[model samples]
Target: MEKKIKPCIDNEQILKQRFLALRDTLDLLSGKWRFCILLNLHYHQKLRFKDFFEVSEGISPKVLTSELATLEAHQLIQKKVEYTPTKDITYYVLTTHAQEIWTVLNTLIEFGLSNRQEVIRSFHSDKN
Candidate 1:
């Protein structure tokens, strides 16, 4: 008979803390449009409200406004108002802190691509 080792309390606490952090991160990023909006900002560097509406496709103006407000509140993005002779143009740009998300986003993209391939393979196998 083999004796099983008990889990350490410190390890359990660390795991719990990690899970809580993950939950907090998900809470902040939760929503279809947030990731899309962030990705657009990453690529474009800066964009106006109308630009988001055009690029994000399928997102309503109301929801975009809300999401942008949330991101701004969280300090993930900055809202810049450019005063001009004609009018004030509002542009959204990512904060320096937002750069931290690049690694997470890239990892998610790789995982998604791998998962899609696996799902396609499984579907094909089931058909046969």
Candidate 2:
């Protein structure tokens, strides 16, 4: 059996506000690298600029820098700078705010797994 997902706030008058909330969530999670970055932080906990290469291939430094900035602006991740004896190291870590997103990601994983075959079939048929 499949689990049914429902909105937490189901009041009629607040539907407009709920849609606005959804838009805000999408704005933060919209870009290519933000979701990937969040998932990376979820697993790895802390990452340096160089570490993103392992997170996702073909992420250029310019794009990574921009995505990191957006994520930080939304409080999804934190940018930390560390000074060692000889060098300054920068790292990114998931913020407490990301815990809720982590739950959503896990739920999405399950949904994808359950729906993969039908989704693939639908895509293939659409191209025919």
Candidate 3:
């Protein structure tokens, strides 16, 4: 007789943990500046490090670097080096995954703008 395969309970627990981790990552990237970065990238094709610094006004260099690194690590964006005779320069471009994320971000932006007054009032009321 052939041996029967049992469903792994531990695998389900691991999958749940993975889901929570993914959710936490999304929440972390949903911050103000991070969202701005994504929106800017969606409109712009690719940007050099300096261009990003210039376009994303008021963002500290350290924070921008950190956010870019996080996005790169998540495979949402790609870093490429453009070779030159003098020096190699790196630039950031959105990946396919990043484009998909832009769709979700757009929907979120539309919803937020539509409900801004309500959200603001709720925040103030909750502070009491």
TM-score of each predicted structure versus truth: 0.86, 0.80, 0.69
Model 1, 1-128: lDDT tens digits are: 99976766658788889889999999999999899999999999999999997889899999999999999999999999999999999999999999999899989999999999999999999999
Please report the candidate that would top TM-score against the real structure. 1
Clashing pairs in 2: none
lDDT: worst 10-residue window of model 1: 4-13
Error in Å for residue 30 of model 1: 0.9
Q: After superposition, how far is residue 66 of candidate 3 from its true place, in Å?
A: 0.8
From the highest TM-score down, the ranking of the candidates is 1, 2, 3
Worst 10 residues of 3 by lDDT: 4-13
- lDDT top scorer: 1
The runs of at least 3 residues in candidate 2 whose Cα sits more than 4 Å from the true structure, single-residue gaps closed, are 1-12, 119-128
- Candidate 1 residue runs with Cα over 4 Å from true position: 1-11
Higher-scoring candidate on TM-score, 1 or 3 = 1
lDDT of all predictions: 0.94, 0.89, 0.83
If both were scored by TM-score, which would come out higher, candidate 2 or candidate 3?
A: 2
Candidate 3: misplaced stretches above 4 Å?
1-22, 117-128
